[model samples]
Target: MYKNLTITSLLGALTIILGAFGAHALKKQLSVEAMQSFETAVRYQMYHVLVLLVINLYDGFSEKMKRTLTLLFTAGILFFSGSIYLINLFGVSAKSIWFITPLGGLLFIMGWSLLFYKFLKISLQK
Candidate 1:
């Protein structure tokens, strides 16, 4: 619920702010590749935020499932988007932490999988 909605709203707002900052402020400061990476992070973060909002609106899930989805999505955003932000903004080499991005991607995949399972279960029950 409301907690998820509130967090998603904040995430959405931050995504917008970060996107604008990347476009205007970091455009000149970062390399073209770094800027692109940063933009990717912002895009994924926003996408998941929207997904979280949609999940919140869907009432078919149990509280535990909702919580699990929230946690997974939140962690995915942190690890995936946060790592890219750190690399581009702080000049951390991607090679040093190549593993983190994929782990985050895995979490994102798991979150979607759980959502799909729930939807299928609900549909089959009808």
Candidate 2:
């Protein structure tokens, strides 16, 4: 878990660095829509990165929260950021797939919700 956290932190740092580069360097080349998409991806990636950090802090917790958080964090990265990057790279203009981004956000919310529930359950058990 510690190793995973460290790796995730590194990945998050890379995401931030690349996000900045995309904003400053590629701004002129990318259209407004693409830029917006990129920013959206960056925003969600950073959000989940912080979420992972919080999960890492609770290392001694039960297995349920650990699994849920891991899945959610991975989904957020693969779906949320992945979709945006794909749209930007491929210039897909139909926008029907915009739904995926929200789904990813929903997954993130669900992950946090489960974490909250777990903490509540644990606290109440005491």
Candidate 3:
């Protein structure tokens, strides 16, 4: 639990730092489209970080479920945001790694779908 918390906290800080870096430092270096993509990555990363934090605090989920959700969201952020950062910062060819971004989005969808399924089970119980 503490490990998850620590990871999530670090991710949150990293998200903020990257967002600021892109805005202030990379603004002039990157094209408008690249800058927009960078911002999208930062936003999605922060959004997932927030969800991970909440999942850590919420006690309703079994430990296994929590861990699974955390892994999914974490991987999603890394694949999605990390790829964009690589492309914008290192001039990596997006065509080479295009599949990765969609895979990340799929992870996010799976995580959310699992959560929704759990909620449905709980709702039906009452």
Candidate 4:
């Protein structure tokens, strides 16, 4: 849990810094559409980072669940946000990689599903 917390906290901080930089530093250079996409990615990344933090807060997460959630969160951060950052920094025509965003979204959904399953198991045991 500590490891997950530490990493997610760092990732969250990075997201905030990058979001600010994107808003102020890159806004002038990027196309409006690219900038919007970048902002959207940052928004979703930050939201999921918080959700991961909450999942870690739960003391009952098994080791498997922890590992799965961590992987999912990492994938979401990399693919979803990373794609947007790249799209803004480079021309969209250069890269044909927009499909990664949905994969990242699926990871985020899986993370939530894992959490729900854990909750259900606990409720049943009680």
Q: Point out where model 4 deviates above 4 Å.
A: 92-95
Structural RMSD, model 2: 2.4
Candidate order (TM-score): 3, 1, 4, 2
How many clashes in each candidate? 0, 0, 0, 0
lDDT of 4 at 100: 82
lDDT of 3 by residue, 14-110 (tens): 9999999999999999999999999999999999999999998888888888899999999999998999999998999999999999999999999
Worst 10 residues of 4 by lDDT: 86-95
Cα lDDT, all candidates: 0.91, 0.78, 0.94, 0.82
What C-alpha RMSD separates each model from the true structure? 1.0, 2.4, 0.7, 1.8
**Candidate 4 lDDT, 20-79, residue by residue in tens:** 999899889878887788889899889988887887787788767877888888898888
Q: lDDT by residue for model 2 over 9-125, one digit each (tens)? A: 886996889698887887998988878879888887887888787787775675566666877886867777878877776666538687877788788778878878888988899
Query: What's the TM-score of every candidate structure?
Result: 0.94, 0.80, 0.97, 0.87
Q: How do the residues 18-75 of candidate 1 rate in per-residue lDDT, one tens digit apiece? A: 9999999999999888898999999999999999998888888877888899999989
Worst 10 residues of 1 by lDDT: 57-66
The count of residue-pair clashes in candidate 2 stands at 0
Among these predictions, the greatest lDDT belongs to: 3
TM-score computed on alpha carbons, candidate 2: 0.80
